[model samples]
Target: MADTVFFVTKASGKQEAFDLGKLQHSLKRAGAPPSAMPEIEEAVQKMLYPGISTREIYRKAFSLLRKASPHMAARYKLKKAIMELGPSGFPFEKYVGKLLDFEGYDTQVGKIVQGHCVPHEIDVIALKDEQHFMIECKYHSEQNRKCDVKIPLYIHARFLDVEKMWQQRPGHDHKFHQGWIVTNTRFTDAAIQYGNCAGLRLISWNYPRKESLKKRIDRSGLHPLTCLTTLTKKEKQQLLDQGLVLCRELHRDLNQLRSVGVSEARLKKVEQEVRLLCEPESPIL
Candidate 1:
């Protein structure tokens, strides 16, 4: 007798054979302990059924992971956490700036720069040494949505206009470097192709192979406050409202948690998770 295969529905509404290996890989990336994998895998397998949505599977695994390790569960939810950064793109733009700032770049979020033809509001501008990057952050609350070719096409034209003006500046002629599109989701193949051909650096959740946004966050220990399973939705929003985005920020100052009405008893649990999530790791790119 042959084994029956289960199909899983992706966020894009496409169906694919459920691959346990992918789940294992995700858990590993979340820094799940090897000892805990068997139980997670077994439990996940038991819950499998035809046409089950990937989001459902993730929640199940996340629940198990949260039980095993809150910090690891936080890491696993990084992508979703990023989406929670926005109903508006402004917070996401600022979050992108914070990531760049962590890498020793001088960054400005929501900066308006003069173009040769007009003024453009750059999402995030990262300056280091001679490299100047005009970054556009595409924030999507829905996982299925993607940054298509039009995004790069539009950003590239804006970049050219800005670069034209930048080159006429005394020191910026050679300083203005590349344009970037950073998103909390994936990019279409056509988008990636156009970006490469046009010399625009594109970054999505898991694109660019080894140098993706996920990899950057993992290495930098810059997990967002929304990743914490310990915090309620309201509490996370309150912290974000106060411009407290990074886990490291909360780890540094517990007063923010207190301000959000977190009790002294619960503060300890939140602090422990933040500390674990923000532990120093590999150097950022």
Candidate 2:
């Protein structure tokens, strides 16, 4: 419904990064009733993006329960089942623990001083040695070639909220240490720039340069967009699945135009035009 085109990681071909086992573990830790696990897990499998973050998955799980129709046994009891399945009732608290131990910022995800806005449903808030660090982890599509702008925006929202709150309240002026925005997909330029301006650490999907992303695209058995600049937003979102990685893939796909070796000079010119876009500083946003 909301732009059906989902950017995915090329490596695993998933729309979002999500771990069902971890979610199960989280639900248990949250003290959820034992009966709800099956129901929630079922909903997860049916509706959630496997590559989506733990928090988002939980949000969807709860949202499902809230809207569950009571008439149909399967649909009606589903939400109740999830609520009764685990020991820890709400998964949010458990996820907070996960965020605390995330990527070396253990126990430091809270306000630096006083007067900072209190966190709401966030993972963890550690206040130690006067430095405040807030870390939020986003589960994203595990695919290596898609694009997403939400993760960064989420992080930015947290940081800006803290900054604004601190500015308004003067007693402690914690100075909001840093915000961590980590995800499995590429970030838009606006997300990065806004994060930089706010001193937020924007960590996008990063893989060892074992091989160029371009190489992966060339090998994938899929049609490529030869004319990216001309593509509509929807077309571009589709192309973001593999088109942005490399033009070689495009050239290879377009070569099919010459199945019998017929040359379309116009296609060649378009390819050359698109080539200029591969530059590092291109305005991808």
Candidate 3:
């Protein structure tokens, strides 16, 4: 490999020297075959341009990976596919609840509960053993957008209000409740700081570095239905609109796809891809 002087633009609008190691690492993380590496590298090299966006690089690599292995490609595209779950945040909230459900918690989405000072509408709530958590799901369609400090400030206030209500209610003194803010995109520095200072748990796509939201989703094998490449955009939206949020749900009831007019052949292809992507051992970074 030669020192390629070309620069690659990142999601945050910063440009840096194109690094092959980073590309190789991503492919390896996605479980791409060792043999496919050379071809992928060659395709990327041929398409290189000064200031090419990382998003474009990813799109090119994913296209090549799809031809090689749809399973690996789906794994690689997990983050972007999540962004595709929304023009709205409701589907993302439901998907988050499903991920929590897979992790052995009893989860509920879109519930209205009475707080001490006011009635609050919660996005997702999860209970396990004797502990319960009220979660606020923040979804962003743009990769660069982030959940900021103001979000946690407001959520923490609401949590305090609700906590007061819980404390005042008899017999509820034995129960523990926590506030969590979960997002599809990353959180800002100030947001993480505020969350930590206020004792509110913050979960974001890449926050906490090693154990990120993406890692959690991958580890649980609860990928959303939008991750499927076999289906067209319209078909994916149709499934989402029909309340099919998780890929595992679609896997369990594949007739849902058939009902939405996907060809029988394509339905089977989607089923196979979903199964492989949601398997227990899918790798994550």
- Alpha carbon lDDT of each predicted model: 0.90, 0.43, 0.87
Which of the numbered candidates is closest to the native, going by highest TM-score? 1
Model 1, range 1-285, lDDT digits (tens) per residue? 027799999999999999989999889888887888999998988888889999999999999999999999999998899999977867788888888998899999888999999999999989899998899999999999999999999999999999998889888776758999999999999999999999999999988879899887876788889999999999999888888788888988999999999999999999999998888653533
lDDT tens string, model 3, 91-112? 9998888888878999989999
Model 2, residue 64: distance off in Å is: 41
Per-candidate RMSD, Å: 2.0, 21.6, 1.7
Write one digit per residue (lDDT tens) for candidate 2, span 1-285. Answer: 233433323243435434566566545433344576678777776664425544455566655433331111112222222222122222322323333333234563323433256554444454445556565544332334333456566667766676566557665475546666544345566666767676766554332233222222212311123223333344333333332323334554654333423247555644553443332221111
Q: Can you tell me which runs of candidate 3 are displaced by over 4 Å?
A: 282-285
Q: Rank the candidates by TM-score, best first.
A: 1, 3, 2
Q: The CA-based lDDT of model 2 is what?
A: 0.43
Reference-based lDDT, residue 100, model 2 = 38
Task: Name the Cα RMSD for model 2.
Answer: 21.6
Count clashing residue pairs per candidate: 0, 38, 0
lDDT of 2 at 142: 33
